[model samples]
Target: MTITQRKPLRPDDIIINEPGDQYSCDSCGCDLTHSVRIKCADPLCEPGDGVDICPPCFCAGREFRHHKRGHAYRVIEINSYPIFSEDWGADEELLLLKGIATQGFGNWKKIAEHIGTRSKEEVEKHYNEVYIDSQTWPIPKLDLQFSVDPAEFQARKRRRIQALNDTPPPPLKHGPVSLPGIHEIQGFFPGRLEFEHEIDNEAEDLVKDLEFGVCLEWDGDQIIEDEEDLDVRARAKWEEERRNPPPPAEKGRIPGKGPMINGINGYHPPSENGSVATRESLPPKSDDALANGTSSGDGDEEVEEVTQPPPIETKESLAFKLSLLEMYSQRVDKRLEGKEVMFDRGLLDYKKMQASDKKRSREDRDIVHRLRPFAKLQTAADYEVFAADVLYEALLRQRIQELQQYRRLGLATAADIDKYKSDLQKRTLTKANHRDYPTDKHPYRRQSSGPDPRRASLVSFGGDSEGRKSNEREATPRLPGSSTGQGPIVRKLPTPLNLANSPSLHLLSAAEQVLCAQLRILPKPYLVVKETLVREYARRGGKLRRREARELVKIDVNKTSRVWDFLVQQGFLNIASDVSSNHASSSQDASTASGSQVNGSPIKDPRPLSSQQNGPAPVPSTSSS
Candidate 1:
């Protein structure tokens, strides 16, 4: 080897130059000088930067793109070596350490990607040399002492163990005892069966035998006597017979027996002394008490007629309640009076019942004839409805009467009077107008009313034709949720009778009946007069004389005469005067005008005084005589 001076190449020159001056192109095999030759830019290549390339390799940006983009090249000049920093800076070293920590050692490809500078091989070599082979780590050693006296160590170990042993053991904790399930218990004890298998098998065999058993010989006598006795029906019959046996032959014919002595009384059947017979066991009629007698010789013996007294009436009595037939009769009477039947008729055949020549079959005709005598001739429902109607009509009439009285006294107006009549019609008459016609034009609007062309004389029910037309004009279609904008005016009727003095007042619903007893009476003398009338006569004891009653109510003698006269004229009190004597007044009857006598009917029209018929009149006040 001759001693020759060689110039060092720059990093850029080294990056493109081949190892030798003249080299074959790896791609074309052309011999290349340093100026024309370049190395492959891939750092991971086997001969990194040593492979020779020609200028053609740079065409179309092949080496300049992808992996080789931004790669450096060398510029040759006079002899000058490249200035390169081979040692890493502090930041680079830190990056290298962090990359190793994250990517781990020998993962050079990933470490290189992270560090962004070194090749994988370079990174591997650096990491292995710096961190593995040449590394000196500071590992702290624990300064310890294991050497000890045998006796002392043994004593300390024993002492520690003794302390642990000396600590009192925790009290034994008892939890709820969990019992095993049936199957679990059976499984645990394999020899034992869960149920009585033999008993079950026997039962199953018995049931099977019973299902397909031998036929039995019929023992009629045994069934009739022995087994039949065990039957519920037979036992019940036997018990019944034991409880109520037949009467003794000696005591059999007790004449004039039972409640049938009077046919009007509740008919009881004939039986033993203690037990009464059912209707089926009663004897047939002996042609005596029945209306049509068959025996001719028995005409000479006068048959005693049984008379029944009227039923006892009490405070709790419903006896005064009218039968449905009576209600129907009352309705017919009212209908004949040329007035609208003041009640709901429901589905009643009132027209058919009234018509004499109405078509009907023989049975229906017979039924109608038979029922004609009874007010309860129709169905129970018809009767119920009829009674209700009569009651309702009666109350309506009473209210009408009260209204008339009120009007007479100028306590109520004509409009107020009309309202009650309208309400009564609405309640009683089903044919009354219900639907309102639209004032506005509507497709389903009610037809406007006009006189029928066929009829020369127009007729209307209850209300007059002109009033009906007026009503029709006012009628307007009501829409859901729309306000009528007019509130109904309510008026109270004037009560005539004091409820406390009336005996049958309890029949009316308390909510409906106005207690005149509690009314706010005008004129202090009027109240005193009423009090005196009620106390002296209407109260339990007996009637009082006029003088005593006037004194009791604390009215003056002259005022008494005026008040008494007023009461009598108003039909509040009934007084019978004595024409025999001038000074002494006869026994006065304190009649509160509670109601009418027919069915304890509601009060009819109250006849007010002639003087007060047209307008309000001042209460008569007699001056001191």
Candidate 2:
């Protein structure tokens, strides 16, 4: 191969570049050689000297007019998908379309019509950015029935029929878990069968090294905005369409499928040899089968009322729990133990029942008139085996819901709080690396370390939340942390458990422990009052009573009397100096003479002071008294 080298000219030959920068040509293939301070506007041109042309061609002068209007274009509004990211590109639009398209493959023709773009090829080429008329997402008034992609959609339907032969998902409690990250296929699913099949097959395939794939569902008529009128309308439309099922695509037409039933909590009928009969073909729901009761949901079928068995005494709770579950499983839905419903031994459903008195026979007109009222469960788990108590079970359920919600909303769970906080702290530290906490090096106390149960929850929850997840293998640690095995981690015990040693005091009141903790955190000045001020504040007849002192102990507030001033000055009161400021100020004003006099010389005031509240105060010489 021969080495090729382009001739280099003086600085004039090359154009220097800065970002937010551009240059362009008069024609598509043109270039410019001359450099100019002005910004180039032609899209086809490259930056260079005054001669505007394609950077390579370097000949045609700039032709495209610059559309500069001084102020940059303000994106006051945009039309976008609600779920799409702020920087959503064009392919996302197509992906979103594929997800929501109702017409299937034929819908591609309307791509230009919907977005006002020129052609399908153009639409795909410029998929990164889709300019919209509105600055913010606008919900279009036009209706498009959403359907699945023809190719994959047909494949999914075929798979669904064949999937009846596939194994069902494992139960919620155990077996190989269908964790979102480890085993899940992201898809636009229609019904429970499709969803569960996807989960089971995808999870198995996932573990077996099958790569993840997308299951896009679309056509436009997906989520109905008017949900109150949705079910009835969708059912009517589905019935109409099902009665006149569309012709095969060889003649060039869309398939008339019924409304989506996935992601809903509803009754599912048994499938026959993988073919689901059209609802139109099925006999109308019998009035007798439904007890002629009113249905809260918009659909025609009324809900069946159920009579619950009487509550059992706590004596045989374990047997009662099993009986109740069995009854509940069999009560309303007989098809529940159907082949599809029952998973293998590890495939048992981790169902929980909560006690509720709301009648299944009630005439409640609310749209969501309770579907099924479960009896109130005493605790989180269904079976409160002697092994798992209320606290442990509640903590576990709380952890699950918290994690699930956090995962769904993409937020930090209580489990991640500490780790997140540490990360945040590190980021903040970077901004102030040289900054220091003045007392860190000193043997000082922390004022912020006041007693708080929330603190205990935070510390305990933070260290142990990650382990609470269902996938977590090890048993939940009863103690605060893995390190707790060696010994109690005093620092992590929340506010030092300062009163934990004082059984009597601990029994006295939790309020007191909290108050004492606050007191421990406060400086001596607030507790100590000057002798004169204390007498004045207390009134002569009121001498700081023992009850009063004890009551103040909760707040760690002290009367600035001879007793308090001495204790404070002697450093008997331990807290931040700012806390003792009140006592110190009072002591300074009252003078140390009062303490000295009480300690040394016998003394009495020459004039007796009296207050309206106290009546008359005595002034006696210590010598005589």
Candidate 3:
């Protein structure tokens, strides 16, 4: 038989034969159940309905309309191997997921049918073992149980809608309505309230006299007019003036044919003619004119003539002028009332107020200046309240200072003052008794014979002679044993050695004191011996044998032996036993050696030992002396 070559399995060769596999390749338009499906993982590429590709198309890196080769892809294999349980393959897990998603979780029979191979009981058992009972489940399980009441929900919804409907709309935008008297002072017009004044009030003056067609015209020397004009000859002279335009008026001068009445350029003194009346020259007003509240002139006539004639007064203009005058008089009256109040309060005296302010402390002025900015923002009522609070705070601070003063004097109250006086008397008596009977601890305390020199010097002088006498008294010194008055005699005794005052003994602890007592050695001498041994031990690299210690303090062997034994027992000195063999030989040789002598005679050991143990005496120079 000829050998047949088997084809190698590609990644696409893993075919998922599950009936639940519904995904198809988007590119080749083939069912994905025969091969592994690849899906575009990019969130932006066909996000709602994801693009899926078969393994063959994916391996070939085919690009669809929305999916590109560069986009990340996720491999979806329905026939993947077992994950949580060996008996359940990935295909069965997928089917179980799909069935639960469609039919809900507790339908075991339907899930088994979807899984195909597993029975209902087996499927339920596997699900419980892998997901519910085991800790390996991927998603956390929540036992949240809640129910909604549709009636209550609907009631709440209706209430919310009703509340929204009942809410009022915002107010409409309009110009602010001023209080009755405010418009006169602020020049605000109530009727035309859009702005403070009419825009371009003088614009009408420019075009009021303009005519659409010329009423008169001139050709050569003859004048002409429109055919509709009945009085063409009457307007002929008027048309000549309009054509010439009077050679344009001079700068800074009004365009007029009349001569200036005064010497000043462009100035016309009020006319002396009775028809053109000046303000000062107007005839006295009649009762009817005054009752009508009209000036002394016809409504159309100019009351005063100067460079230009003023506009004829209308009812509105007269009313506005009268309101302005009334507002001015009211302001004047208010000012007068304020002045009277200031005079009554003596606030009108500027000089006195300034002097008083100058007398105030710098700190007070600084506080006022600092508060001025904040004061400006406050209303009258707010400012009054703030001022009251400030005064209260000042009163509290004053009370606190008084309390502190009383405390410093040891008399915070009337009862405290009585108690303080009694306590002071008792303290004085105790001090006198202590001075009379001195303690033994201070035997050599200086006795006061005369009055204290410092106190004598501090005494007030009655006269020059008395001051000189007090100075002479303070200059004199008293004998040591002599009494200032009939006081008891205090003898000066010799002071004893205070062990507490000893500097060396201060270094020893209670344990060291016990060891020192057992060795019959004073703590000072024991401390000296310890210091010497410690220095030698450290020099010997932290190892000291008994033989070396004995040789180091050989002056008085008995005392040195006691201190050494105490130090060794207290763990201060560590004697190495490794040199025991050499130490024994050295001891023998040391015993044969002569004793150390201060003079010619050899020193003798006070406590004799066996010849095998005896060596040179060990005595620290500090203790031996």
Candidate 4:
């Protein structure tokens, strides 16, 4: 096999060449136009005009006088590629700019002609792309000089002032003023300044043939001269007419006639019998008589009334009014045509439209009512979406309930539920197995030989048998001499028992025992009264009055009063700081009495003494008083 070498590629082969390409390579002296031209990237390498080299020179790594092989280089291919559009050429862009400068902007046809290579549309688009849309292009700033001439400024100011002065004052009445006969024109929209069918639809014909143009001779000087001449002529004519007044003719007479009646000018002569004719007697004028310029009344000096013709309108004014009316008529006709087409197509059927509107309204009302609870949802779509979500949630809740029921029945298929049931069954079996083993931890689990009579009887009763049995056992009558076998025997002693042998008396102090004996109160009753009085004293800020203390002890008022006196005498109750000053001597005496009674004997039975002696027992005088 023979080995063949491939030919080297040229820049022109990759990029199409254009006529405007002018760049040249410095190393090989080759035209760099329409090809990739290499330039030194270093700014200091070549200051203004950088060295350019062809692609071949760049590939060969050839060095020039100003550019070196080591220096970084950038490639430039002028006219080889388009920046915006592929079809546009660089020369065409140059032509576009030249055309804009010569023919001015907006003259797209002339610009396109100048740029013969591109059409007007392409030229306009290219210009806009480069100048308006592209940021790379620089925009020229205009230096506008604004100066107003003194004479022109003064003239403008004067004209403005005159215009302000000429402005009409506001009317006294200010409101929506209705024009007379405005309602006669059907479909007349004042806001739009248009009307329906006009009264003279053919008014445009009047001015159709009239041609208008500027008359150069009608300048200010000519107008003023004409006005002056017209004024002088009018004055001369008025004087001549004033001097040339016609002579008065004979009343109600015509030449070679008897008395003329209703002759010319509708005048009438009087009757020959010297009777004044009444207006009712005069015959009315007929159409023929009016056409012939004559009247019907017969009198000496009376004239019949005649209607005058209206003033004639100018051609221009009449045409303008007619044209406006015609335009309105055309508009009305066009609107009617559209309505007629709609009616013909059955789109404007009143009954069908009304029914459809009512159905739509009913559906809207129903939707609004149904969505009233979800008022936060602004749009119908939002409401519908939310309602669907709610429905889905309800389905999920029902499914969850079904699953829960399945789980409760132990028929669930879920792994967790099955695992839980298995675990529960295992725990139950394990407990049963544990019970069978009879571990020491649960001694009650030991099997009994047989059911007890009490348990058997309790099982036979449906109610709380244990509670009933307990109540019965507690209610069982016991002899006073008998004792319960549970613990120590506690005897029920009489209230008059000696305090030394009383179980409750040992808990009291010596002074409390002595006080109890003196009051003829049992140790229990004495302690109860003492606690009540002390609570009342503390509640009243440590001050217990005699009557208040007696009220607090509800057991026996006389015995409670004695106990209160004993407690007060022993200084057990003291007045609060507020009343302590008044009870200073009493407090001092009670303190001395309490000190002496601290060593008193234990309580003795006071019940027997109270029963034997009717008089009050003598109390100890422990205080100094």
lDDT of each: 0.42, 0.36, 0.54, 0.53
lDDT of 4 by residue, 396-448 (tens): 88789978887787764678777877988987864443322322232122222
Instruction: Sort the candidates on TM-score, descending order.
Output: 3, 4, 2, 1
Residue range 134-253, candidate 2, lDDT tens digits:
244353223334333445643543453355335353333323333432114323232343334332232232234322211123333354446345444455555676699765643222
- Candidate 3 local lDDT, residue 474: 36
TM-score of each: 0.10, 0.15, 0.18, 0.16
| Model 3, runs deviating above 4 Å | 1-17, 129-625
| lDDT for each residue of candidate 1 in 5-31, tens digit (9 for 90 to 100) | 455444443221112124565666776
Which ten-residue region of model 2 has the weakest summed lDDT?
Answer: 616-625
Q: Which candidate leads in lDDT?
A: 3
Q: Which candidate, 2 or 4, would have the higher lDDT against the true structure? A: 4
* Pairs with backbone N, CA or C atoms under 3 Å apart (clashes), candidate 1: 325-375, 325-376, 437-477
Q: How well does candidate 2 match the true structure in TM-score terms?
A: 0.15
Instruction: For residues 409-448, write the lDDT of model 3, one tens digit per residue.
Output: 8675879967877998987864454433323354222222
Question: Model 3, poorest ten-residue lDDT window?
Answer: 594-603
The best candidate by TM-score is 3
